[model samples]
Target chain A: MEIQYILEIIGTVVFAMSGALAASERDQEQDWFGAAFIGFVTAIGGGSLRDIMLGSYPLVWIQDVTLLYIIIGAVVLSGVFYKWLLKLRRTFLLFDTMGISIFTIVGMEKALSLGASPEIAAIMGMFSAVMGGVIRDILTNEVPVLFRQEVYASACLVGAAFYLGLDYLEVERNTNFISSVLLIACIRLIAVKYNLSLPKFNRQQRQP
Target chain B: MEIQYILEIIGTVVFAMSGALAASERDQEQDWFGAAFIGFVTAIGGGSLRDIMLGSYPLVWIQDVTLLYIIIGAVVLSGVFYKWLLKLRRTFLLFDTMGISIFTIVGMEKALSLGASPEIAAIMGMFSAVMGGVIRDILTNEVPVLFRQEVYASACLVGAAFYLGLDYLEVERNTNFISSVLLIACIRLIAVKYNLSLPKFNRQQRQP
Candidate 1:
C-alpha cells in the first residue's frame, strides 16, 4: 500500500479517537449516538469540505466505506475504554497532533491537484486540518478551540508553507511530504507542552 | 431572465441583511469588518456548501462575485439604518423566510441536477436552507436556531417533499419550484407569527 494511504488511515483513527474523547471527557453521560456522531464528524468533516470545495465528487467517505466502519469501531473502543483512556490525555494529544499534521499535508496536495495556487493550497490545507475540530466544537455547544488561543491553525499553516516551499525547491515529493507532516506535529506538540499560544485581541482597559 | 435567478439575488440580499442585523444587534460599536464578514458568511454559506457537496466547482460566490458586493452593501445599509431597521423586525422576518425558501428550491434543484436521489435532494434542500444560519450562530457563539425550538428545518423538508412529489406527478418545473418556495416561506412565517415550535428535549421542567 502507498505510504499516503497508510498515513490517511492512521490519521482517521487518531482523529476519531480525539473526537470521541472530547465528548466523553465533557460529560460521561453522553450516549452512544452523540459520541459516534461527534467522532464521525471529527474524522471526516475537514476532508469532506476540502473535497467538496475542490469539486471532488461522492466525498471520501462515500467512496471509501471503510472510514465509516473505522469511525464506528473507534467510537465503540473509546466508549469501552473511557475509564482507562481518561488517564491518557497525553496520548490523545499526541494522536490529535498526528491527525492534524496528516490532514494538512493531504489537504495541500489535494488543492494543488485541483489547480489551486500555492497560497490557496495552503489555506485549503489549514481548513482541511482544523475545520473538523471546529465543527465538533460547535455541535457540542462550545466556542471553537480554533478561535481560542491555540497554536492549532498556525501549525497547519506552517506545515503547508513548508510543503510548498520544498516543492518550489524541486525537492523529492515523498521527502517534502514527510518533513512537512513532522514539522506540523512537532510544532503543535511543543506549543502545547510549553503553554505557547497566539496573542489575543482583547481590548485594553482604561485607567480609572 | 429566469425567475430563479431573480429570486436567488433577492435571497442573497435578504440573508445578508439578517446576518448584518445579528452583528449590529449584539455590539453597537462593532466595526465594519465584523459586519461585512458575518453578512458574507450568511449570504453564501448554505449555497456554497450545497454546491461543494454536489461537486459544483469555483463556488457560487467565485462564479458571480456580485454576491460579495451585494452582501457588503446590505451590511453597510443595515449598519447605517440600524435604528430604523431594528423596528422593521417583521420586514426582516418576511425577507429571511423568503430567502431560505428560495434557497431550499435552489439547493434541491442543484442536487437533482447532480443526479442525487429524491431523498438526498430533499436533504440537500434542507441543508442549504439552514446551514447558513447554523454557521452564523456558531461563529457568533450561540447554539444554532435550527437545533433550538423552531419549525425551521421541518418547513424546508416538507417543501422539498412537495417539490419532489409535484415533479413526480409531471407538474411544470416553474409551478413545482414556485409552489415549494411559497409553501416553505408560508410555513415559516405562520409558525413564527403563531409562536409555534418543536417540543424541547429538556431533561428537567422549568421551575416556577
Candidate 2:
C-alpha cells in the first residue's frame, strides 16, 4: 500500500510536469488559464478516460481531490522554472518515460481487476500512458506524439505485456510492478538515446 | 422511443459527415484509413466520453453495434463525394450543427436520467455535442473550436438550457426535444451566416 501510494504520487507529479511542459511549449501565446487547463488535462486525461471506459464511478480524481491540487502545483512549478525545464529537456523526457512506465502498470492492474481481458488490459495501459499527451497535442494544435514515429505506444505495450506475463507466472505484486516499470523505462531511455523511432506511416504528407 | 431512434440515426449521419469533412480538409495527406479513423473518432468521441464519465456500461456503440456500420457507411459516402461535399461547405456545416444539436438533447437527457443536476446536465450536453470535434481537431493537430473564439459551446449551452426549462415546466418530452434541437440548429446557422463569434480569451497572442 505504501509503495502503491508512492507510485501514484510519482506518476501524478511527473505526468503533471510533462503536461505543464507541453503546455508551456505550445501555449506561450495563451495565458495561465490556458497553460493550467492544458496541464490538468494532460495529467488526468488518459486515466480519466480509461476509468470511464471501464465504468468506474465518480472518477479517481473525484475520489481523491488532492490530485487536482497536485496538477495545479505542477502548472505553477513549470511556469516558474520555464527556462530551467527547457534546458533540461532530456531530463524531463526521462521523467516522462518513468511516469508513463508507472502508468502502464497502474492502468493494466485496474483493467485486470475490472475483469477485462489481458489484451484489453494492455490497450488500456497504453491508453492511460499516452492519452494525456494525445489530448494536449490536440488542444495545442499538433499531431499526437503516439501517432508520430516515436516509440511511444510500443514502449507501453511492451511494459504491459511484461506485467501480464509476470502476473500469469504468479510473480509477487511489488516485484512484478517494479520489474515492469524498470523494463519500460529502460526501453524508453534506450529508444531516445539511440534516436530510435518507428518507421513513418505511409501517409499523404510527411511530418515536417 | 421511435423518435429517439430516428434522432440517434440522424445525429450519427450528420456527425459522421462532419468528422469525414474535417478529416478530408486537414488530413488529406493521409489515406482512407486515416480519414476513416478520424471520422470515426469525431462521430462517436463526444458521446462516448460523456457515457464513460457518467459510468454507463458497454458504451453506446458496444450496446448497439449498428452504429459502427453507419459510421463506416458515412466514411465511404464522404470519400466518394469528397469533391461535392467540399463545394457545399455551408450545407455540411449545417449538418454538423444539426448533429451537435441532437447530441446536446441526448446527452442532457441521459445525465438528467442519471439524477445529475440541471447545471451538470447542461454541461454534459455541451460536452457531448462538442467534444467529438475537440478530439478530431487534436488528432488532426489543431486547436479545438471551444478553445478558440467560436460560438460552438455557447450554442449547445443555450439548447441545453432550453431543454431544462421545458422539462421544469413539465412540457412533453418529444416537444421539448424538437424545440431545443431547432433552437440550437437555428443559433448555429445564424452565427455562421453573420460571422458571429465569442470574444477571444485575453491571451498573450490573440488568434488571427
Candidate 3:
C-alpha cells in the first residue's frame, strides 16, 4: 500500500480508539449508539467542520462509504473488546497520537490543494486535527481538550510548519509526510509523558 | 416600535423563558455560564444555523451585540425570579408558542427574500424555528425535542403554507406576516395540548 493510504488507516484506528476510550470513561454502558456516536465524532468531527468551513460539497465522509464502515466496525469492536483495551492505555495513547499526527498533515495538505494560503491551511489543519476531541468533550459535557492547557493545537501548528519547510526544501513527498508525522507524534507523546502543558489564561480577581 | 421589532422582542423573551425553564427542570444551578449558553441557543441557534446554511458571513450573533446582551440579561433575570416563573408554566408555554410562531414567519420571509425556492424556504423556516431547541437539548445532553415523535416541524410547515397562501391572495405584507405567525402558534399549542405527533420513522431493522 502507498504510504498515504497506510497513514490514513493508522489515523482512523487511533481516532477510533480515542473515541472508545472517551465513551468508556463516561461510565455509560458500551451500547452500539453511544459507541458509534463517539467513534464517528472522533473519526470525522474535525474533517466535517473543515469541509463546512471550506464549503466543500458532499463532505469527506459522504464521499467515502469505506469510512462509514470503518467507523461502525471500530465502534462495535471497541465496545466488544473494551476490557482488554482499557488495560492498554499506553497503546491507546500511542495510537491516538499517531492518528492526530497523520490527520494534521493530511488536513494541511488538503487545505493547500484547495488553494488556501499557507496560514489558512495551517489553521485549518489544526482545527481539523483537534475539533473532533473538542466536539467529543462538548457532547460529553466536559470542557473541550482544546481549551485545556495542553500542546494539542500547538503540536499540529508545529507539524504543519515542518511539512511546509520540507516542501520548500524540495523533499520527496513520502519523506516529507513521514518526517512531519513523526515529529508531531514525538512532540505529543513527550508532552503527555512529561505532563507538559501550555500556560493557563490568567483570570483577574475582582474585589468583593 | 415597528411591529416586526416588537414581534422579534417577544420571540426573544419567550425563547429565553423556555431555556430558563429547561435549565431549572434539570436542577442545574442558575449560573451565569449555563444560563447564558441556554439563552443564547434558544434565541439564536435557529438563525445561526440558517445563516450558515445560506452562507451568510459573520453570523447573526457575532454581528449583533444587543442580542448577546439580551440573552445574558434574560438568563440572569430568570434565575433571580425562578420560583415566580416556575409557577407560570402555562403562561410561559403561551409565550413560547408565540415565539415559535413569529420565528417561523420571520425565517420563511428571510428565506424567501434570499430567493430560495418555496420548498427550500419552507424547510429553512422549519429548521430556523426548531434548531435552537435542538442545540439547547444537545448541549444539555438530552435527546433533541425534534427527535420526539411530534408535530413540531409540521407546525412550521403549515405556517409556511399559510404565508404562501396569503402571498398568492395578494395580501398586505403586515397581514401576511401576522396571520402566518398566529397560524403556527395556534397549531403548535393545539398539538401540544392534544399530545399530537407525527408517525415515527421505522424504515428497517439492521440487515446482516
- Supply the DockQ value of model 2: 0.19
TM-score of each: 0.61, 0.60, 0.59
Best candidate according to lDDT: 1
Candidate 1 lDDT, A36-155, residue by residue in tens: 899999999899878777676778899989989989999899989988887888887888889999999998898888777776678679878888888888788776766553678888
Candidate number with the higher DockQ (1 or 2): 2
At residue A151, what lDDT does model 1 achieve? 78
Clashes of each: 0, 2, 0
Please give, as one word, the docking class of candidate 3.
incorrect
Per-residue alpha-carbon lDDT of candidate 3 for residues B1-208, written as tens digits (9 for 90 to 100)? 2989778877877787678668787776667677777887888988887766666578767987887777777878788888888888888878877877888888878877776666557756876888788778887778666545266667887899989988989999998888898888888888889986553211223435
- Rank by TM-score, descending? 1, 2, 3
DockQ of every candidate structure: 0.12, 0.19, 0.06
Q: Write the per-residue lDDT of candidate 1 for residues B1-208, one digit (tens) a residue.
A: 3778989989998888887777455543344545555677788889888887776678877556566677878887887787788789878888889988999999999899989999999999988888988888887787787877379999999999999999999999998899999999899989988988777668687699
- CAPRI grade of model 1: incorrect
User: Candidate 1's error at A53, in angstroms?
Assistant: 2.4
